[model samples]
Target: MKTLQSTTFKAIADDTRLRVVNLFVTSREPLCVCEIVDALRLPQYQVSKHLTILKNAGLIIVEKDGTWGYHYLNENNPLNKMLFTFLKKYLVGEVFDDDIKRLEMRLLLREEGRCVVGFVDEKDLLIKIKEKKQELLVKE
Candidate 1:
């Protein structure tokens, strides 16, 4: 599923996407689309659109419980696995500031829910990056 892998990378390439992923990664609870949008201070439609992209890339999953759509990281996805490995090796030491981490934590807690962390696999990371680049091209 080269296409899947590519889409996954694309989803992660944007700063917004990365932040969304980070929120999912560190969140202690699941979050709904509204919660995510409010947490990120993004428009509802934009957040939904991004979430849709992430879901398509297999980086995230939506669980429907009644009228709520909870988004969580999909650790079983191959692309996410790779992202985790890469982050552990190269990104962990970057030292995110307390404010940023707190912001992330606060965002995660917005809807009073729980989320599961998912790892990005190797192939998916590449695919995601490629897709992100393509998106940039389209914007240009």
Candidate 2:
């Protein structure tokens, strides 16, 4: 018999899930799976697997828009909100810091506050950032 306590803890027991939670903690914007994969430097399937576990545990929620599904931490429950605050305070390290940096870079691809491009690999991300900068300059 898995209670909510056990299920919630179990969902975050894995290192990958912890990382995913950390991303959600840091991000104010909901992210799509591909953005998470690119930020975590992991395969989409691997990230998606952890995402499913988090979803099932009620730690996060997904809002689907057409083919893209944006995910964010679920804080509707008081316990989950408290857990989110705790994780935001405690989950730290070079690895997590790197994920945030990569995620910030990935977020540059968002258009009008939504993810427009999918899976911008690290190399292409740099080029895309440069292009975006040029576009901004042109608009200015």
Candidate 3:
């Protein structure tokens, strides 16, 4: 049985890992690693590293669909339930809020009825960001 005695605490001990947990908790939807990178504005490798730690710690679960993998909170674990409850009630800081906001924006990039634009490189993201900005400017 997975226990919170070590891995769970270690997983969330890092600020970035904790933020990633909060992202999953708040969204209540499995998120892809690319979406996480875009939302946190962190490098892909860094986010993937955090994700691996979380997965190893049993704090998150991965679901694979073809080439895409989505990460979700391991809600079935009792320890995770307690931790998520605490986080949902108390972790209302600006950084988490900002992640959620960016996550919402990232969702907007989806091609309607599909998961996000699906794992674009940094260059692609930059181009998309510029296009989005232009669209906003035209609308305003």
lDDT of 2 by residue, 7-107 (tens): 89999999899989999998867999999999999998999888998998999999999889899999898998888899898998998999999999999
User: Residues 3-103, candidate 3, lDDT per residue (tens digit)?
Assistant: 45676787889999988988988888888888888788888899999999999988889998676678988888787798888888777999999988888
* Candidate 2 backbone overlaps, count: 0
Q: Report the candidate with higher lDDT, 2 versus 3.
A: 2
User: Sorted by TM-score, highest first, which candidate order results?
Assistant: 2, 3, 1
On TM-score, the leading prediction is: 2
With a 3 Å backbone cut-off (N, CA, C), the pairs that clash in candidate 2 are: none
Output the lDDT of residue 137, model 3: 87
Q: Relative to the unseen true structure, what is the C-alpha lDDT of residue 35 in candidate 2, on a scale of 0 to 100?
A: 92
Which ranking of candidates, highest lDDT first?
2, 3, 1
Candidate 2 local Cα displacement, residue 50, angstroms? 1.2
Which one wins by TM-score: 1 or 3?
3
Tens digits of lDDT, candidate 1, 1-140: 46765766777788666656666665534667655654565667887888888888777778997666888777886767777556434433223233235445444322223433222233353564466567768989
TM-score comparison, 1 vs 2, better candidate: 2
The estimated TM-scores of all candidates read 0.59, 0.95, 0.79
